[model samples]
Target: MRVHIATDHAGLDLSRYLVEELVAAGYDLVDHGPAEYDALDDYPAFCISAARAVREDREAGLDSLGIVLGGSGNGEQIAANKVRGIRAALAWNLDTARLARQHNDAQVAAVGGRQHPREEALEIVKAFLAEPFSGEERHARRIGQVAEYEATGTVAGRLEELRPREFPAAREA
Candidate 1:
């Protein structure tokens, strides 16, 4: 997989560490970077660039993902998700990381550099990279709803269409 990564000054060291570690693990990496630590730098440009690369690469039929890091990861996640088709998730642990991919099929993961130790953060990223989305019908349907809403600004009659005709009876087998 091609991994595109970016971070602001707050996450510079962790970003460097992740690049080195992920590269050594045989994954192709693209660093959309600040290049040097600048305290006044903004996260939106870097995070959005990485997210856009992931979107473009995937659209071009390449397997790609993105990582955006910052002190708390909140702003970075928000920035990445601003891209129309990108699903960015804030993942703080192994389960959250894995579920981000499995449940949401998120293309971008936002990690808080200050939230975990470097090794732990690495583990979280690894979990995210390894989990495949569970392509269950409900999951696909929900993702479709989100995509539809994103493109059309409304889900319209989707809820009505998907509603169960009647609740299952409360009977014991």
Candidate 2:
């Protein structure tokens, strides 16, 4: 898999570490940078760039994913998600990282630089890259709902399925 990564000044060291380690692990890595750390740099530009690259590559039939890093990863996740077709998930642990790809089929993962040590972060990224989407019926159905909402701003088909199910306890009340 080709991994595209980008980060702000706050995540510069972690980004570099990830790039090196991921490369050593035989993954094709692209670093969309801040080649040098600049305290005033913003995360949106880099994060969005990485996200867009992933989207484009996927559209072109290439297997690619993105990593956006920042101090808290919240802003970076928001930025990456702004790309129309990109699903960016904030992965704080191994489970979240794996679930992002497995359940959501997320193409981008946002990692908080200050939240975890470099080694732990690397493990999270590895788990994210290694996991494949489960492609189960329910997960695909849920993901389709999100994609439909994203594209048309409306949900169609099976309104009854979307309706909230009443609880038996409420009926008893």
Candidate 3:
């Protein structure tokens, strides 16, 4: 599988480590990176690039995924999700990592560099990479709803029907 990775200065070391480790593990890797630490570097540019790569690769029928990292990973996750057709999940533990893939079929995972030790973070990434989407009917239905809403501005069912209409003008007091 192809894995794209990106991060700001906060996660530079971790990102580099992951790149080397993942490459050694035989995964095709793309590093959309700062290339050097800069305290003022922004996460959005790199994370969005990585996310876009994943989306484009998938659209081309390639098996690909992404990882965005930062000090807390919160901003990185938000940035990645801004890309169309990208489902980015913040994973702090092994279970969350696994579930992000198994349940949501997320294309990108966000990890916090300052939140855990390097080994634990590596384990979390491993779990994320190893788990496969369950492909259950319920999960597929839910993912489809999200994808539909993303493509269009609306979703089906009650939410669509309940869209608020403009209120009639009230009589002047």
Candidate 4:
């Protein structure tokens, strides 16, 4: 499997460590990186690049996945999810890592570099890479619904269709 990784300065060390470790573990890795630490570096560009690569590779029928890292991982996760067709999950532990893949079929995982010890974070990434999607009917149906919504901005419900529109004017007190 091909594993793509991206991170800002906050997670630069961890990201570099992961590239070496994952390579040793026999996974093909693509590093979309800041290359060197810069305190003011942004996460969106790198994370979005990794997510886009994963989406494109999958679209072309390749087995690929992504890993995005940051200080808290929240922003990285949010950035990765902004890419259409990307299901990015924040995984703080082994179970969440496994479930991200098993339940959601997430192609990308976000890890908090400052939240755990190096060994623990490595274990979390390994768990995420090791688990296979369950491929159950319920999971597939739910994923399909989400993908449909992403594609059309509509859902099969009474909720209003999502679109760009002005909000109602506020009432005077």
In candidate 3, what are the lDDT values of residues 86-128, reduced to their tens digit? 9999999999999999999999999999998888988999899
As for candidate 1, its clashing pairs are none
Error of 4 at 105 (Å): 0.4
Candidate 3 ranges beyond 4 A from true positions = 160-173
Off by over 4 Å in 4: 158-173
| Per-residue lDDT over 51-78 for candidate 4, one digit per residue giving the tens place of the 0 to 100 score | 9999999999999999999999999999
**TM-scores of all candidate predictions against the true structure:** 0.91, 0.91, 0.91, 0.90
- Candidate 2 lDDT, 32-139, residue by residue in tens: 998999999988999999999999999999999999999989999999999999999999999999999999999999999999999999999999999999999999
The better candidate by lDDT, 2 or 4, is 2
How would you encode candidate 1's per-residue C-alpha lDDT over 74-170 as one tens digit per residue? 9999999999899999999999999999989999999999998999999999999888999988888888889999998879796557756778889
Is 2 or 4 the stronger prediction by TM-score? 2
The lDDT for every candidate, in the order shown, is: 0.95, 0.95, 0.94, 0.95
